[model samples]
Target: MPSLTAACATPGMRRLRILPACLHEYRGFSALRPWRRPDAVLGWGRKPTALKARRFAARHAIPYVALEDGFLRSWGLGVDGHQPHSLVVDHRGIYYDATRPSDLERLIHAAPFAAEELARARRCMALIREYRLSKYNHAPARALPAGDRPRVLVVDQTAGDASIEFGLAAAATFEAMLQAALAEHPEADILVKVHPDVVAGKKRGHLLEAARHHPRCRLVGEALAPWSLLDAVDSVHVVTSQLGFEALLAGRRVVCHGMPFYAGWGLTDDRLTCPRRGRPRRLEEVFAAAYLRYCRYANPYTGEPSTLEATIDLIADQKRRHAQLAGDWVGIGFSSWKRRFVGDFLGARARLQHVARPDDAPPTAGIRRLVWSSHHQALEALERQPPAAPLWRMEDGFIRSVGLGVDLVRPLSLIIDASGIHYDPRRASDLERLLNDTTFSPHLLDRARRLRQRIVSAGLNKYNVGTPAAGLDLPEQHRILLVVGQVESDASVRCAAPEIATNAELLRRVRAAHPEAYILYKPHPDVVSGARLGQLDTEARRLYNRLITDISITALLERVDDVHTMSSLAGFEALLRGRRVTAWGTPFYAGWGLTRDHGRHCPRRARRLTLDELVAGCLILYPTYLDPRSRRLINVETAVGLLEQQRRTTRALPLPQRLYRGYRHLFIERH
Candidate 1:
């Protein structure tokens, strides 16, 4: 029997071979190539060929070597008559040109080639099972901890210059925080693991030399798999690190310095303060609210479902490629889309899963009933008011309810209008009951209605209104064109006709503009609540209200154009109803080159547009959604709730300076 080396010396053998003869031969014979070294044989091929060859080598207990270049030359084969070919070998050490018809005839005549190939296939199958068993075995053992000392691991991949400055700053801040925390807790050992790909020189290192100077800090350069490190660490600290949330999944405490989406959840003690005042909720509740009510994950670019893992893989690959081409040191604007995709979508999902999932038990009875108070006025009211009393206040130019007790329940949020004040306390009672039965009470609905009436009457009087009305009265045929705009003094942008501006503005504007059209003008809901405009005196409110009879814009448009605004959200509501909007000043939906911009460039207003293109841009773009109080990403609904509460009360809570100071000093200052 000819050995593989001996058969290689035969004429036309190499030329006719297509797949690497070594790969084919290794697939068949186990005993024949006892001296065939694992590292010496180099395989050259395309990605698919390499994958197949690697998979085969992995199966046969043979080490696979990759050739960076010279695919055809290394294979010792060529195209024959414009057709590709391959070489195969049997366990008996017989070689055959897979492409040549005569080769098969010769092989059958020589030995049991079919039997040999079958044996090789069986071995490959066995190898696959063996590999899977080893890979999926119970997670690897964690690193041994120093006695009586907590172990902290900080994982990041920015030790290389190819990373952007932000990445470097993030890495540095983590290192600093880890060292500082270690100093505070001398018994803790701080372990910094460089990313595996970076250690392999595929990316830059995340740790610098300065990071290692701390006596307690140690840099683990080798690839110590993620699960192993996560298991070993007592707590994980990160500056927007994905591993921080991953640690949370494994039941480790996480301390975040940056405004990672996870930080606002009530699970971890956030070093940074959330901007809006919201009830501290269980992680599961937050997840349910965010996913069920507020957010959806689709492909950032396509608005389609791409699995989370696929998105992460694409982002990781793109980052690597971008770094290589651009030589790193990029700015926020350069990678804003990628950052938004990761932070807004991926990070949010991870936080929702890890932090929001309920632990084994239900929430405590007391916690379920608690409503977070936002301002000092609310706090003061809570302290002074009766246990079950309902109260409202003007805080930070918004109306807010104060106090929490068995009877002090908020039903559906109150929406006051000219017809009368209305709120479905039953709906709120149902929702409260759904969240927790112990906190729900039917009497709370009665208390809420009475409280709403009091607040409305007070608000109307404060705004110098003679009566408390429930709903706006407008003609059925009138196309209610709610012109939402920023009022400069509350009086400068009033209607020209008192009836039209008051209750008949829509009718008057529509009739004027279309001569046959009817329009209605409704005062902004914010103004009616006596929020930001509550400071205005009676003369101001009356003068402002009367001025509705003189403003020329409605007369000029010659349409029953009702001026309506509820602190700008009305613009969105009006747009939803397909009403034409005219701006007195720039609102968020104004500059999208979408609506009729009476203030700026109005190019070809004849073209009709889709609602998505207009609304998505305003809600998803324009406003940064920063919590003005905390300067963090404002949870949209929470912000809206707080703003509403503030408009009702004169007393407001001061910003949480301590939280802001800590966040800036630890994360933003270093970054």
Candidate 2:
């Protein structure tokens, strides 16, 4: 946990030894003693400084280690915050382009694969195959060639890339490979798949103009994932590209025109030679050496060290979330600035179209309309003249426990889906459907349970609004009941809370039910910020033992025996934290055999559900999430982690700004 310090060395001198700092910022290790320096030093690649560091370490009689990324990266561009899932740290030399018998070559040749190691390799490979996972999780848009004319995929790498520069390929090698493929597979359908960097305009490739016009050859410019591209092709042609190795993994015939890392291993058809790797290797043996032994993985969300299996599952989940978010363009009715939060979650691929009125509708092909159920005009118009686009009812998510002291608080998350909104009783929602229809898989249930544990342990709330617990001195014998208040005008209360119409009525009911219990009343954040109505007067407030405001929902949940609510998300958040929840209305979390439901229960929801099933449906499956700061789509786990970080560090607005935002909210509500 020690910060890198100049004091570790003499003034203006370089760091004598590299500290064992985590490649990711979220992880940490205690500082090593000055006298007990590392036996070796590690570098990602053979950069100039790395060589110099090696020299320096050698002079000090310390071994030097070089490093590089392993396979299976991420869906995002690595230009920003994304880090690699795997890295190779070698004491013999750099792995990718070692001059003479690198550590990887030694390991692949001499290392023995234990039975358990082989089993792990098999498991990893199976998961990759089942998920269709690749370095990048994107799938190709190109359709598979029908009738099987023997398709050959010629993989193109960025010109002057490390693999080409270090291995047997050059700048003109890609063009030469393309021509060779065309000549050899004259009757075959030849498709040239470009590297991701080329498609993203980060780098250029060799054969675009000529390859596009060839009669039998087609140039694919899209940045589709290589694994998906490999599925449609019968054979792969590469010059020292990783796709050649991946081709062997996919069980496709591979033709390596140059001496790539995987060539000469008897697994590939090599046109070139690597005499050092003369020994034959099974695919699993090669896999075990390259992946299981040589690489280390870290959790994408928490940045803690992780297993390859867990990492694969997370990547699959993230990729699925990304695709769902980008499904279609979204048109929102009666929009506000906060609607940007919803739009952000949908991501850049899904364009946001503002519809001020019904007449302002745009093209409806593959379009989705987001309607707030409270807006009667927009809702009625949609019902009367239904658009071709699907309906995505939008609302706040369960962990929406935070708001700025002012009304300008940005949400940590929002829910937008094709099914009915969670609060509305007019139609069935995605959550209701999943609860009714899903036969829980043990693996998914286990994942959900682990996720729930992390959320609870981290003390993460919906908005991650930072509020400390109140230091309360309670009568030891009194039973504590937390009464959650909500906006009476809110859709959830109006449509679901038939018995308790107002905050006062909710309080009255809780008090009447437990006359001897100590009652703690908490007004909704919206009401407290003056963005909406429903705050109690002094006399009404006096009915409760204490009116809590300055405490966080997490803190309240810990102290209370149970929570009483008229269909507020606070009840759901409390449930996640292991608090007893008594639902006065049929909120989405109720009727699932989890909460104590006093309202209507659907007959379809007769199946007993676990905490993970509820979490999987509500948090992971039901809602789409975006990192508000980055305005990009993210997975549920990442959303929770980011919210927790934001909660701890976020600062409130100044008095003037707070007053202005409060006024704005009040104006909007009054209108």
Candidate 3:
């Protein structure tokens, strides 16, 4: 019987050779024989490949056409429009989807004849020969300086996927290990070589900047190959970089701090464990298992054979495809699934509903009101758009502020004082003077004189509804509104400031709203007791009795129906506990169409929502936290704990300068 290979023989059709223009430009086509003809040329994005292909075709007097998924789809012969597919063209300029037999038949029928197709096939073969992979065996032999100390070399490709941001912590750990190793082997010379591709300026500077602080660390930003560096060093240290395996090939010791694909392979000493474990194997064995056994890394993004040498080419191809089909990419399975499964899909849907229908929404009758007093321009911009809930402004006056809470004024509405107050920097001086004064400590004061005059002048005497403790006995189901202010004369209602006097009227309002609600007005933690910039001339407790309610907010919130505030996190906390949040001012969470807005019209007013959605939006989506060293997103739990601790300790929690530097490097400088 004839050999089995003879059964597969067919005439006329031949394998096509596709060569990128860069191949001819760099490596000449001297190897191509006349018998092998070029069919159609292939290249990357629209600009370079198309231009080069056209030039080659013009020079050779052959027909050339651009290869693209969109061009194929225009002929109504492509798959899914966004699916990764390839094209083949004959000598007569007939094109077909090589992946499909029907497309090939169509091309054959549409073309002149089999002779022309064969000629195109021969041309492709000629191009393929020109682009054949060549062996590179010019690496130098391993060498190290004669010494008892170990020589360490750190290697990594600075370009592509190697990022210092994600690997900074591991890099720091490796640096520490390297230092310890250097101390143990005092004569050891540490050499850090940058990746040649990276040194060529394809990416930002390598991890050298992060490691520069160490005296022993050095950056080699030249065209030195990683393999050459590996030959010189006795050992290697890495985070999850590919150089670890390359160093293994060079018969060097490797210490890994992160779970690179090579980790747990019994060869290198990995400091971290792989979260997803498989059958244990050696380092080489893992590489074989990944590349040769289990994983077949075809270009899933472009549906092409993704050889290691052509990986970058395939990536460029896919990137071009992504750019071309940018809008359609969103509707694809992967992106759609991410938005649905990993994100707040339900909340997004609900928000969409709220946005679509605003007329049927119910009124937020019982929320607090807050006003922006100083930044009139900012306030005007915010007020132009109706807030999701009701918010009262300072222009509405104190009577309207109290009316939101008063039972006789408005039964179901919660009252929040939106009057803007001034934040005075000079108050710090008066506070220091009052604290040091012998007779007038914060605990003692003459309320009949100065305190009474200030309250009477401020028109707060009428809103005096007695202490929160005293008001609890009144036979009315009411909610108290606490107005917390920032600085004394700043005039803007900020929650994070250090003054309590500006918030005095808010505490008074809360006392009037909920006689039973224990209205506790705690001063800002930043403010030291007995420190007064101005004299109230009354003991804090006595003034509490004479001018306003003596209800602690902690106790009041416990029994109250809801909280009212202007952009305060207290409203967030209240919302977290299932208490109705009447935002009398605009907070980050206000316009999300979740909370009750007192400032503008309520669009999606009556829709009851889960607390989780509100929490997810505010806590997860709105704020940005930076890792102090890398300036990436900080751990949320860690940030919350830090904020809580700072609140308790009353110490400054300034962001680390390194984090700011990292931010500048990553965002501002890159842009």
lDDT of 3 by residue, 1-671 (tens): 21111000111111112122212222212222234345434332233324555566566665443332211111111222222212222222211111212222232223233454445334322322222211111122234445444568765444333223333233355556555556655666666666544555666434555345556666666543355566567888776565676666557898876555455546787665533343344433333332222222232222223332232222222222222222110111112212222111111111211211123333343322223233355445445646644432321111111211111221111111122221112122111222223232121122112322332233221112222343554224434443433223333244322222245544444455555653333342112111112122333333232222244333344455656554454565555444577665544345445677654432422233334443332332222222222111222222333333333444322345335444544564335
The better candidate by lDDT, 1 or 3, is 3
The lDDT per prediction is 0.34, 0.70, 0.36
Score candidate 1 by lDDT.
0.34
lDDT of 1 by residue, 303-369 (tens): 2233222222223322222222221111111122222221221111122111111121123322111
Candidate 1: count of backbone clashes, pairs at least 3 residues apart or interchain: 62
Q: Higher TM-score: candidate 1 or 2?
A: 2
Worst 10 residues of 2 by lDDT: 7-16
lDDT tens digits, residues 1-671, model 2? 43322111111112211122223321222222345454444444665545555655667776655656667766565555455555665667555563456777887896468889888898788777766777666553345547458789998776766667667667777778888899988888888887656666778887665567888887777767677678788899998777887788788999987666677778888776776787898888888877777666664444456667776776776677666656665454655765556667665546676767765776565777777656777878876775577777676666553454235566655677677777865578777887778776665677788888888888776655536676765667999989999888877888788777788877787888888999998888767667777878665676689888767777888888989998988888898888899998878788878899887766656778888888988877776666565565556776666666666666765677677766767686678
Clashes (backbone N, CA, C under 3 Å), per candidate, total 62, 5, 48
For candidate 3, report its TM-score.
0.27
Among all windows of 10 consecutive residues in model 3, the one with the lowest summed lDDT is: 4-13
